[model samples]
Target chain A: MSVSANDNAAKVSVRGVLAKYSVLIAFAAIVIFFAIASPTFLTPANLFNVLVNNVVMLAIVALGLTIVISSGGIDLSVGVSVDMASMIFVMLLAVGYSGVVGVAGGLGAALIVGILNAIMITRLNISPFLATLGVLFIGQSTQQLATSGGQPIYLTSGYAADQFNAIARTALFGMPTPVIVLIVLVVAVHVLLHRSVFGRYVQAMGAQPGVAWYSGIRVPRELSMVHVLCALLAGVTGILLSATVKSYVPLSGNAFLLDAIGATFIGTTLSRERKPSVIGTLLGVLLLAIVKNGLLLVGWNFYWQQVGIGVLVFLVLAASFGLRRVAH
Target chain B: MSASVLHTEVAVSDEKQAAAKSAGRRFGALVVRLGAIAAFAAIMAYFVIFAPGFTSTFNLINVVEQSAILGVLAYGMTSVIIGGGSDVTEGGIDLSIAANMGLCAAVYATLLSMGYGDFLSVLAAIAVGMAVGALNALAVVGLGILPLLATLAVLNVAAGMELTLTQNTVVGASSPLLGVLVSGSFLGISALAWALIVFSAIMIVVVHRTSFGLRLYAVGGHPEAARAAGISVPFYVSFTYVLSGFCAAVASILTVSRLSASTPGSGELLLSVLAAALLGTVFSRRFVPTMGGTLLSVLFIGLLANGFQLLNVSSYWVNGVQGALILLVVAITSFARGSEGSR
Candidate 1:
């Protein structure tokens, strides 16, 4: 009996390790497969482009999502925040405003959305999911309305074009500006989430709101702050995205919503307790960025590439949870 | 002893508290029904008073015709919400249903254009829809992923498949059968509207008059209790998704027939479908989803949009107005519940 008990314990531990590290393993496998299959995949310039061009905005959005999920809520409106910012920023530039003022206008728009989300969720007792869904619908229509039926705004010629391009294009220490911004934001969010008092309270509230409230944690305030912080990150992403494209596509920010959610959930698998973390989200973003870049180089159609990413997300999640359930 | 006397007093107070709680719950239900009725009346009055041509019989028929597809989608949403377990709002949301409909429409249109008969195309479309339902069940019931996330992942897959099938272009089903089904009217109503009414009636009977329906409500109200009563909880949970897929399949067929074409934009109706279903809850006394209520809400939204268009409001603002109205209704409903609980 003692020997059997020891064997069962060992088996459970093995399953736990597999559940935790499966995504990492899959990430490495994908990288190797792409490197072998495509001649350009392993090139330094291509890889750098993937890091600089593909992952920066996604990484920022996922970082925000990581915090929101850690606080036991979701912000489906994050994409709208990005979209609204882009709309305002581009409209300002079209009217001949300076880039700095345009960016401030964009961030201000995102801030209002964040506050409205907090009011709905905390004050009105709405579920975060439904609240954000409402915001998403409203946001989409607002952009369409502002653009007079959803036309994209281009910065054809002005200081707006030069200054915006420089924001994303200029490199420091041999790295693109967006990559540098991503690194700085990642470190700041990592430290804030892992070491700050507010972060601890957010985690506690997520684990058990009733218990956290009884322990004197200000649950509502922390939850609202998390949403505000998330919106700010999305705002930054909007600014960078418009800068990179030199255009504002109405409702374009919606493309990132599902990917951000996917990356954050994938991040959850990295923790034994399934908590969200900055490093895990970074890894998730890298995996997605690489898959996208690699698939494009391999001549896959745009739609089929989406299909592949969806399958990847589903398989990783199923494998992890299925194995854990069997072991238990 | 003094302790026994004190225990008796405590029991008496508990009985009083329970009585008060039930009373508050009844009041809450009353509030929801009344609020919904008032809101519906207000919308009608606004349209009749402010918007010209809105009161005409022709426009009324047009509104109902426009709402037919939404009515079917809402019926599916209602069934899923009622049959799922606790956390109904989150657990019952099937984001892939609209995308599933798009894929079905794509498949049906493709088959029709390839010289296949109508019967084969319809069967193929439904089969594909059910196949997606099976996947959703595997992810949600079998693997225990959150319903919202699982359906969302499937949504992407379905949309991708649709894009690949259509080559990112609009395709039409231009056969005689589809044309007749869309254009032929019976008893002064179009075939599409008739289809919606029949589907809604069938769903109402299935959801309210069957043993399966009772079992579903039991599971959704409390999963452990249902399990203890020997019901297969996972089976019922997964069955709702299957039913939802069938509804989408049927809706897609009608939609493709009506429009004579299917495009990537077909998936954009998801938010409106969800809103209609949620708004339906306000018409219920217990805040539960019902097919009759869903049909009414769909009509309400369709008419509202028509009125706005007559008033020269941009069609883009329709979505915002719908969303804002839903938020207001939900707020009132939840506030009533909160007050009841506090009482």
Candidate 2:
């Protein structure tokens, strides 16, 4: 009987495997298609350049978003959180802080913001949606009031700091540091989510929180931890953004939140499962980035890559999950 | 749990015995929501005593003129929220609204400047805003995407288009006071104030005295129950957005009339409009959007903005205060108290 049950499980697993890989398969096809379309697209230089410039910070932000989403929560403030971090980082640099100190301070600020989001949701019991939205507003306001004049900060000297610049500039075998960082972080987070005890707790909480709690899980604490990690990742993105642009804008993160959320949700359709897959999210982000890249390469007249992302997210959602439950 | 069950039975018995009394109390609680307006009035009264030019016809007229567009947008938002959807879903923040209105103003002005007819240019602006709002609704309700995420995406799209087209400048108005009277009033009343009074009365009549208003409340209160009652969930959801778009269009026109030049990318004001709409919800004891509540909320915000300006407050302070006020309202209404619902 045990052998028979195992065999049944194996069959189910195999089906799951196929469903999960469909999105990756599409992604592989995209890379190959892009490679054929533009000779320069797959060259090591462009590959590394895009990875370093277009992708890494977003990947980190996406990772945080994934955790929140998996637990059935969301953070509309990630973009604003990143903006606040950039402002703080720039201000620190301007005030004569070392590169290490500035980056650390910026990330710490973001972490606090993240925790606040968690507190609002878990402690005060505000719906995650409304709470984060309020945070988003507060964050934008922070950027406006952080400086007396509400101007974007310039990290004049920090940009030239080799150590800081290395975030975007350093490469392993002609691959950028961001790509290396993304790979390492993804692999680590994947293991943390899938292979650890905490991982099991998270999934259980997401699938059924009350049941999980009755069965001996401290759900709120675990969820709060997830919230913190999201903010930390967004904060890191802020630092990376400054390194790439050599300056900071107040609202830079505003453009990334929805696109990352959309990409994350779209990625889930690939794995075709109840739970989000790290690998699937990576593929989704890649697909979205490439689509935007392709649009730019072909000189598409539509200026709202973000808007296209919003619409694409809708398509993905309709195909994967039905609209938020109706009365029935 | 057992004691509460007994209490529930007892409460039910008591409720049946005093239905009329209970309903009267409920109505009284609703009237209390009007206290916010009194609070605003008191604040304004203080300003009148302390701040210079606080009661001047010119400044009073300007305040009415300034709030007209925001008031209109709040009306659209209240409709959506009454149906239980959050306004922020359609990029419903004041900032987005202001930015969109600004862009429309710029688009109309530029076209008119380029020899396009006023009517044609105005139509184009309306079309653009409606299309954007519809796209937002379809993505969220039809496509199963999150509202906030979808709307912000449109926000970017709108922003990008505005920048590309306007090169970031004001458009539309060639006159110093083309539609200023739309905001001005007669017989010691600002026209804009009068417009709101009329709008609120009409909307109140539509929502409270019509089948549509009843359906809207039912939809918001319980979607499954509403569906069971045979309401078209998706249609109403989409229709609300279309209405919202229509409001944005009218508001944009009024905004252009006020600016005499459309400031490109002014839709960012949607954030404030959204806040006002949400605040209006709390003012109704029912926690549903009432036309009177929305109008009052607009007036409240308009008064606050006017008071700040009169008192020499900074714009940054204005934003912080605005954000704080919204957060407070969200907090107050977040859980809804233990009081039995009218349903």
Candidate 3:
């Protein structure tokens, strides 16, 4: 009986490890598959282009979402919040602020939106769904109607501050600034999520808030911090996006909503028991970037790309969890 | 004797005041809901009387026909919400409905134009639609992913499939069904309105009569409790989505008949339809997606849209206005829902 029990325990441990590793394996597979399908996919220039072009700010927003999802919550309003950031950033620059202030102002507006989300989610105990939905309406409409009577606003003057433009177009040590920014964010989040005691508390709070409460953690305040950080990251995402596109559009953030959620959920399934992890989320985002970059390079039909992403999200998540019984 | 009589009269008047207060609260809520409906009616009436051709048979038919798609989609969304899940996955629904219409139009138009039977095309579209709905159900139920996220992914896939199949847009079926579906009026009402009325009637009955309806409300109200009580939450959730899928297919048929082209961008209509469905919940008590409430929502939006054309203003204003309306409704409804939870 004792021998059998020991064998069972070892089997469970191995299974746990496999479930976690599958997420990374999946990312690796996609990267390799795409590289073979399209030689340019693996090219340094193309990879850099994909990073700098498609997913600078989104990576930041995804990082924030990872934090929120860790707390067992979700945010649909990020798209709108991110969109609002672009408008707020542009409007500030148009008002003739310095580049530093423009960036600050953009981040500041996102923080306010985030705080509102936290309040609605906390004080009112509203589900993140309803709360974010409320903001989605307000944010999208605000973006669309922010200018004079539903007209689109463009910044054709002064390059919206030269330094800001450089952030998007310029590279850090031969790497695109956005990619560099994404790396910095990933490192910062990794440290914050893993090394910080506060991070552990968030996990505890999500997995079992009651127990965390008994352990003397201030749940409300912790949740507020998490939300604020999320919004701030979203603000940064908006700034990056605006710089890259060289203008702000109301629909700028619309595409990210599903992708972010998909990435996060897919991220959760990556590391352990198909649960949330910092490393897993990063890998998931990378995997998606590869697929997107590869598809664009090869000129795959737009619809097929969407179908592939959908199938991948479902398949990887299922596979990640399915491997939970594996002994090795 | 006089003092006793005075005391009795005072007590009677106090009781009457208490009764009046209670009635006033009830009346206030009713008035608020009705006022929203009335405001929409007033707007429509203003257009009908003031704008040329606003009340003409052609324009009237246009309004009803436009509303049918929104109403059906909204109604479909309501069924899922009633089960306590937001269809938030991609575009948050079985968006293949529009695609279904497009697909049907393609299959039918090709066959008809090529001398194949029109009936086969229609059947093909519907069969594919039902299959699409079932696919959504299978994915959502089988996977423990959130309903909103699950359906959202499916929407993307379906949209992709539709695009690939049609290579973009397709010509509508050769024959228009407007004459048959909407040209024949009953009881002094337009046929489109009558068609909508019949659809709504069936929806209400389906929600109330069968065990399916009961299962839906139960699952939405409290999934764990319902599950513990031996209800199959997954089955109900999947079933409602599948049913909504069929509704979308039917709506697609209607739209193809009216427009003569299966538009690529019709996929986005789900968002507007959902907004209306959510608005209907506000008119309803406690997230109740009542047929009357949904129809009222349709009327409200229809009035606004039709009124816009009459005023000769750009239709873009309607999006901003609709967005505002949605925000306002949710803010108000949530405040109401929140108060109960706060207590």
| Least well predicted 10-residue stretch by lDDT in candidate 1 chain A | A319-328
What value does the lDDT take at residue A319 in candidate 3?
61
Model 2, stretches more than 4 Å misplaced? A1-37, A158-160, A172-175, A194-216, A271-277, A301-328, B1-50, B55-58, B84-107, B136-164, B167-169, B175-197, B335-343
User: Mind giving the per-residue lDDT tens digits that candidate 3 earns over A93-143?
Assistant: 877877677788888889888998888776655556556766766676566
Candidate 1 per-residue lDDT, tens place, B1-343, comes to 8999999999899888878777877887687779878988998898899999999987988888788888887777777777664263246778788989999999999999999998999999989988888888888889877677688788888888999999989897788768877778888888877887788779888877889888888877788999999999999989988888888888888888878988777777787888888788788777777777788889989998999999998999988888788778888888877776565
Write the residue-wise lDDT of candidate 1 on A1-328 in tens digits.
9999999999988987888888898899999999999999999999988987889999998998888888888888898999888889888988888888998999999998998888888899776776887888898889888889989999956788887877878998988889899989999999889999987988897777789989998787888888999998999899999999999998888788888988888887788677889988988888889988988999999989878887887888887776677667
Instruction: Give me candidate 1's interface root-mean-square deviation.
Output: 1.8
- State the lDDT of candidate 2 residue by residue for A222-328, as single tens digits: 88898888898889888888877878877779667756876676666664444666776776777777766755655555555544544454444543434222211
Docking class of 3: acceptable
Interface RMSD of 3: 3.6
Docking class of 1: medium
Q: Which has the greatest DockQ?
A: 1
Which parts of model 3 have CA positions greater than 4 angstroms off? A1-19, A91-98, A115-126, A146-164, A192-228, A271-275, A321-328, B1-62, B84-116, B169-173, B176-191, B222-234, B290-292, B307-317
Model 2 per-residue lDDT at B76: 77
Lowest summed lDDT over 10 consecutive residues: which window, candidate 2 chain B? B87-96
